[model samples]
Target: MEKTLYVASLFFLCFWTKAQENKPYNYFVQESKIVDSGNTIEVNKKGDTVFVAHYKRQDLINTSNQDFIKTYKGTPFFKNGWYRGKVQTGTGMEWEFVMAYNIQKEEIYLSNNPNMEATVMKPVSFTMEGHTFRQYKNQYYEVIYEGGSQIWKEYGCSLIFSNSSQRTGYEAEGGDEYDGEFLKTVKYYLKEGDRLREIPSKNRLFKLFGSKSNDVKNYAKTEGLNLSKEINLVSLFRYYDSL
Candidate 1:
């Protein structure tokens, strides 16, 4: 009987050792970024959407590669008007979906970094002080934002978003001026020291459209560029050189 007991104890030790050797990997998600400590998975490319799953059991059935998606809402701060942009805050708030703007045709363009592809367009149209701006389908807003002082080179005869709410009066970023729904006049400047301004004049929109005046300015203060007609090769080499 003692021999039998000794054999059983040896078998238990071997089983425990095997279990420790085959521990499952651990992973955590943050915003759009994912980190795996166990080195179990790999990301083949950037901006490539992937599926993730959580495990509650020890068995393979306890694990999953299910897809999970997050959503976010952003307010615009352009001279045009307020817009609702989408955001995804998975795991942590590291990943974001940003919309690029185009001044030529006066439209909003959506894209991720490294790749500039026009996916969706947020139509903007409104009248301010008897002036009207419309997207009209033919025109589009393409977001051609390049980080750093490179934004200054974007000034031209075309209209561009200041990228900040405190900015007003436009300076040529892509064009000499900005034209669209949110802006009252064709020629305007979006200077750095300008006051945080909006189109439709809060009081005027409230009196004319019967819409909330402060609400209009509030939305524009946070989001820029309203709807309008629109008409770019983005030369990164030139942009970098301008820096």
Candidate 2:
């Protein structure tokens, strides 16, 4: 009788451990696609693998001493007006720049840290609405240097959830201005967690855009598709497979 009881207890423990690992949770976006160094991979709707994001690393590169205008010779961080930032880990080391999205309070955050030895524009810090989110809801903050200039920058965006489980979407904006034009916008989409979500073999027409119906329409037109079509993981995979 004692032996039987021990075996049953061991069986129950194993079952519970596996159950915890597979607990069902809702991920706002089904998946993501990221590109770096000419390599692109789609992280499909299934969160089984993360091929395109750096989630858990931190490194600080101090830029409190140098002037951005002098270092780059007043060229501005951008000419064509593209958003970019470097990845840092806990050791204060730097990594490559790639278009990225992360979550804060169940929303996505995008940011890049400055390089070490750069000057800061001011004493920089951040604040969020809730204390439970002290670390969890942290956003990508700007790193300013000593001459009151921006050395580098980071951005954050979040997906606003719907009352229904069938839809999910987000919006973001951050970049430089040039040639008398400023650009910023918002967007929304439907995604399901069960499908495999990966980075598209190429950047998606949707990811590179904003909420403007015209711009989205133009991009889709360039790709020989339509902007108003609703998509989920299964349909996305089928579309990619046909391509």
**Using Cα atoms with residue i matched to residue i, what is each candidate's TM-score against the true structure?**
0.17, 0.20
Cα lDDT of all candidates, in order? 0.30, 0.28
Pick the lDDT winner. 1
Per-residue error at 50 for model 1, in Å?
36
Span of 10 residues, lowest total lDDT, candidate 2: 67-76
lDDT of 2 by residue, 1-243 (tens): 698667655743554455346423222232222111111123335422222212211224753322111000111111211134333434333333322232322222222332211211111122222101112124333322112111222333333222221111121332221111112222322222332122232336345223443454444456665333433322333433233
Worst 10 residues of 1 by lDDT: 68-77
Model 2 residue 28 CA deviation in Å: 3.2
Error of 2 at 153 (Å): 7.9
- Where does model 1 exceed 4 Å of error? 1-84, 87-96, 114-243
